[model samples]
Target chain A: MSQIPFTDIVANLPASVPFVGPEQIERERGFTFRAKLGANESPFGPSPKARDAIQTAIEDSWEYPDATSVTLRQAIARHWDINTDNVLVGAGIDELLGNVVRMTVPPGGAVVTSNGAYPTFNYHVHGFGGTLHLVDYRDDHEDLDALAAKAQAVDARLVYLSNPDNPMGTRHTADAVADFRRRLPTDTLLVLDEAYSEFAPEGTNPPVDPSDTNLIRLRTFSKIYGLAALRVGYAIAHADAVTGLNKIRNHFGVNRVAQHAARAALEDQAYIDALKNEIERGKRAYAEIARRHGFTALPSFTNFVTIEVGGVARGDRLLKALQDRRVFIRKPGVPPLDRCIRVTVGPEDQRTIFEQAFAEAVQEVG
Target chain B: MSQIPFTDIVANLPASVPFVGPEQIERERGFTFRAKLGANESPFGPSPKARDAIQTAIEDSWEYPDATSVTLRQAIARHWDINTDNVLVGAGIDELLGNVVRMTVPPGGAVVTSNGAYPTFNYHVHGFGGTLHLVDYRDDHEDLDALAAKAQAVDARLVYLSNPDNPMGTRHTADAVADFRRRLPTDTLLVLDEAYSEFAPEGTNPPVDPSDTNLIRLRTFSKIYGLAALRVGYAIAHADAVTGLNKIRNHFGVNRVAQHAARAALEDQAYIDALKNEIERGKRAYAEIARRHGFTALPSFTNFVTIEVGGVARGDRLLKALQDRRVFIRKPGVPPLDRCIRVTVGPEDQRTIFEQAFAEAVQEVG
Candidate 1:
């Protein structure tokens, strides 16, 4: 039988997934995790109002969601005090990352990102046949200055940075970030990912001028509003960037429940404040646990905490040991950072379970 | 201010929206339709079990959905008695259509579809810079023989056909479709969109055959399953096509609620039977109404019925009149078929409202 032929680019691309979910791990191992803390999901759950909105919208699942997502975008704009014209909502920051890459990057086009930054963004750049220039992180944070310089040197079309960074939970101060943005080449667009911005220190996120045409800031309901499963995220950019997104985005990509739920979640400020407090409590508890276990907890501005385990091999072993004891956690893949396991803040119960598992894993690995 | 430059293809493409959703129309008119018959939605709602699943999963909206879509794909595989390797689920048929087009159509490649067939498929083809070859419908049905000939003549990379066709609500027997599939060139990939398959008469859908290497069948929960708002759909093809999708697909595109709801919907055969019966009743009622109004109702295998309004101008006038009466229905865009207006089957109450509105619109247009 003749086989179906794929495009040369698709044929050459590897069948790779960015991150495997905990459910897939369980399915493969025939064992479920006792504490599902690996994926940085908010175990505190979505707002009660968001849940109510989802339930109310259940019966209307027969209709397609509004293509423009007008209400949700308006709500997001009001919350941020920005114009709706500057906001573009998508499935998640992940999908938005894919879109931005597809828009600017062509075959052999230059794009720059940190070596150990968000892999999904790199995956998208690769999928679109772009040449990726990787810059190494400095002092456990995304080195914005180095990224900007590299983009200039390579004449990159795009540069990516995630503030309140993942895996290491490190962040650059607002002034530092603003300085880096000003220093970047005018032609290169900066993708400032603030997925964890809500949990960052008050002044950690720079007050980006919406009129700044060269930068786009991505934020997510996944982290702060606690609606990751609904998959809603937005990018705040100039009107041209937003309009350019319309040229390529899946217009009705946002789900109806997501739209309603995200709007409600954005309105429930009290719920967000309460969740923030809970996350702070979890972070402190995790730091205490790390101190008691003889590991050094990295200074963090986000919900997750990362602790140094002295060696990458030892960190991997400890992570495996935690999984073996029914606790799930993830460590960075690159060196220096690979010596640490990143744990997201959760409810007291899951945190306690993670603490006990971490102690046991540390002892075993040691 | 300097503007970020887009890729050559992106710069060359026109700013176009594929479809104008009914919600946009309602927003612009500042009036809600009393009888919402456009967009071919089920209107009967999803299965009871699916509704319950969505409600139960509401609280877990903070967590990301399983990236693999394991449970839903497993259920789909079992339903078709095919291996899991043959199935790949996505946000919806719209997304899958885009993916298929991207992988098959290099820039300027030829794609074949009927003149006024599903515009979303055509939109995807255009989005990927594919040249579209349109064949006119024959006797108000998609001309399968003509489509095959066009595909051969154009050396098309992809040929799209919607069984139990949209806009016209017409279909051919399974044998005729299978014969047409056999006549297509081996190099041409056939995208058989069966979005309305569940509402089709018996023998309308070809038997599931995973060994057909050149054929890929698209199915959706939007129609018979009534989960359009949830945005879940699947493509069943040979393993090669299924595997190729991974290279370009958004891995976490399907929402969690959609996956759970679709799984529950697949298991609720009783609910599906009831929905099918309701649709049949609605179809008969519509046909009776058409006869009473001196219009001819076309033979339909799908959930909607298309009625001839004499000519293109009459059809346009009738549609406008219906809209003025706060009833929303759609007509095909092409010449001969434009003489008809298509109405979807809704719940009993909505259909009664539509019946009254149809009478008023006909009298006014006359």
Candidate 2:
């Protein structure tokens, strides 16, 4: 018999794009990747204190985590010098993005974003049946003026811009971000994803103000704080915007061990600082590999370096050959942006493996 | 300026009920509870092997978790002897319930549940704008026949049932559950919450079949497996139902530590069998306490006991007094059933503490 009817919007929508995990790829390829530098994860892991916290919190796993995430929220509030009301903790930036999209963009409403900004954000927008209006990146950085113009043209409810963006590691200054925020329609919410903000140059993140209503800045421990697998992220927004998120988010979504570990990670600023230095070195290593191979490596302010591969066809071939050689790397999906492969910064040994694999792939592809 | 424009549905939805965390209660009351027999958590904690896995996985937290949760799904699939396609892992039963509700019920569609069934499911139903039709619990067990009647009456898109139910801790026979499923309208999907099923009698769970399209069974590691704070739960459903869930759920929602710990927990069946024995002892402890206090403790098939306080007002008074005495416990929210306070079973000392506080509360309230 046919299955019961799904909601009209969901039923009409295509099945979610299936995700092939690295493990699945390993299973299919008949060998494990020698270096895992695909996803833009923090190569340097969490602080020892944070790891200790996870172990210590293991015994407390029987208890339900505080639904309000009181301790973590208070910690974040103190970090930003804002009230707890100004912070909303979620499972991750991905979930927060979905919540923000659901709260702002109504079904069939318009949203504007750089075409290749964050596919997951686009997924959420589409899941909610929101129409996305695209603005192409300017020189691999989010085109703030073009995004604002598109939002205004569509009278969009929301606009997305990733500073020190993904797939292409680039950034706009804090002043530029603030200027774009001011230019956007006041009624439109700007979702400024700063998942890599911790790695950006000085003054890249706008000064957070509790009363700021025009934008929300999303941050995660996934990159700098080095807790990607734990899935914790926060959004700094107006109290009302935070309240709007509360109306839709799962109350106990963030796990207890994650909350404790993240709080500890926050206290270990030195750990983050040292990791950034290491990440900066790793990024340089990736650039060096590209230089040696006669490919242009884009300037990066984030954890990964994007190397130009001449064209989409070359990029695809190189990516496949790298996978064949058991090196994991990713590239941008849509074009004008698809002519490069993005490699996450890794430790020295992993970088060496990636470099060797890259040389081999290039030899075969060429 | 006023807040950015929220979607009409979210704007119109009730300000999410303010959650008063148990920690906040302790803070306000100026003391911590001596006994933490609330929230239906397994005080037994996770297995030693699972905890070890949690510690071991802490180093891997720098990487993003496998988005599809492949290995954990494989473990669960083997445990049930079902196809991996039939299993979908989520952060918790709470999150899974929300996803299932979102996928099935449309705006203004009807969903049937017991009046005092799982509130989180009701929250999700209302959040998605589904009109809830309540059928009171039959002797504090989910009234399956009444639920079926309501679903038929309203042409409901979904019906929620918790065998070995929460709060009241009563359950229906497997034969009854299977019969109800057979009689249910094919169009109305039964959301079978079996979170406490592991603590149930050997034959209590309905035999699982991968082809079952009319219902989906949800299980959690929170109860007997003792991993509530890690937020791991899984649903065994028809492959089509599983595919529908994939269309909207957060891909990397389950965290890395949880994935490893749950896999380990699943392997340690000896730990589960032992916890069930401990839970059985704790349940008997609650019954003995009820006997001494002249209260009727509901016969429980799960880990907790519901002690009747004679009336809703009395139950409210006893609950508050117990809280004042630094004893954390919970009572049902709605009336008729609200005459009882549900106490999650704890260890030997905790059960004694609960009995003493419960006696004190009764004396003061009387």
Candidate 3:
């Protein structure tokens, strides 16, 4: 019998997953890690209120989730001082990114993003058959001017930029981002991912511009809100963008627990503030550890610290050495960033254990 | 600034959601549903083991879900006595259906489905720019033979058939479906949606044949498994089909709680068997209620019963009257199925309230 033919775009796509979970690593390695610092997950768990909300929502799992996610969407809108029409809730930023790619990028359409910056976004672009124009990072920060220039040159449909970016944990100032947006072509949609915004200092994110039809700001509960596994995220954009997303988004994709938990997490600003303080302390501790090994830690605004590990080969050796010692960590895969290992800021105890493991890995790799 | 133009396909698509959720109706009507039988969600709730698993998983909400969904996929594969490579887990069958469309139906590609079978499937087809070839249902069941003939006539890339069908609550025997599959073109992919298979009697679903590359059978936890809000579903297909889906699926879209809860729910066979017996009783009760109103309840093999409401006008009138009484139920939007109203087989208490409301609705409509 003849096999079903895949769409041309999907037929030529790679089978590799965007990011492997730490759980998969543990399964393959046949043991649990002493510290789970990779993937930039929040080391502090969700707030007590959010956990309680999740437990309370458990028995209600027989009902379908509110398709519009009205209450959660309203909460997010109120939190950002924006109208409800400007917001769209989804399974996470990853799912929302996929929808955005589908919305703006037709087959063979052009998109732009920094090289080695959020592989998942690039995966979505490529999955939808968009031609990606990769602009290399300059000095560990996404090159906004270069991205804008490339978007103009290609007449790109979409351009992605994550402020307080992943891997390097570096960020562009809000003013810089606003300037970048002003420089981009009027019709090019800029996907401003603020997944790590909650961990960043004030003034890192631009004010919500609901009138800007060419911008969509994505935020997630996965970072400071600490509900990554719940898969709740939202996009703040012009009402037109929101309507475009609603036309094709899986209405009931976000689960009931995620809705309730995220609302509770959003209400608990004190918990977030306390967690941010704790994360700052952990960052300082991580930086100190790097200094102890005569290494440099990149200035970071996000929850993770990227420590320069001499060179590309040394970074690879150090990463593997840490894994061998039952410590989970990640290093960037691209050239300049490959010389640094990214580590999540954990609680004091985890930080202590990770520091010891890092010291040992460094010595062994040397 | 010029608005970021949507892809031509998306730009032309209407901004209509597939289903108006009960919660959305409650919000619009400014009251809670007295009897929510509209969405066909289980009133029995999830298995106690599954509830326990969800509670246990809440603490780990900081971690991203296993991207591969390895353990749950393996459990589903073993339960069906199929190889793990044949299984693909997703947020729900809705998400899986979208991926299947993406896998096979290119832009302007032809697809076949029963008219008014499932609007969500049609929504995905239209969202992806596929040309729909809709065949009318025959005798309250999906007309598989007609669907196959149309698929061949149109050179359709994908055809959807839901056994133990939704909205109508009717099904075809396994032998009939097997014959239907044989009549289809070798290149056409038959998406056999067995969402309600657990509610059907034995010999309804065809035996798993992983060698058939053109057939993919879908099952969900939202119906008999009683975890609608958790949003977990899986497809059993050939490894090639599985690989194609993996290439484009949102790898971490399925949440951690869903993975754990669905696995526990699957293991609790006793809960499902007992729930099925309860559902059968509820169906009989519903039929009796229909008889009291001089209506006919069609032969049902699913959790819901579709009662003939005399004519299209009465079906529309009764549906509105029921909503006026705060009893939420649905009817097929296309004729001759539009002459019927579909109601979920809720627990005894819910059924009693629904019976009263339904009786009131029929009297008012008449």
Q: Which candidate is the best by lDDT?
A: 3
Top candidate on DockQ is 3
Q: Which has the higher DockQ value, candidate number 1 or candidate number 3? A: 3
**DockQ category of candidate 1:** medium
Per-prediction DockQ comes to 0.74, 0.71, 0.86
Q: Residue B194 lDDT in model 2? A: 96
Which segments of candidate 3 are over 4 A away from where they belong?
none
Q: Per-candidate TM vs. native?
A: 0.98, 0.98, 0.99
Model 2 clash pairs are: B91-B231
**Which TM-score does chain B of candidate 1 obtain?**
0.98
Best-first order by DockQ: 3, 1, 2
Query: In candidate 1, what are the lDDT values of residues A242-289, reduced to their tens digit?
Result: 887888888778989999999999999999998888898889999899
State the weakest 10-residue window (summed lDDT) of model 1 chain B. B1-10
Query: What is the clash count for each candidate, in the order shown?
Result: 0, 1, 0
TM-score of 3: 0.99
Worst ten in a row by lDDT for model 3 chain B: B1-10
* Positional deviation of residue B40's Cα in model 3 after best superposition, in angstroms: 1.2
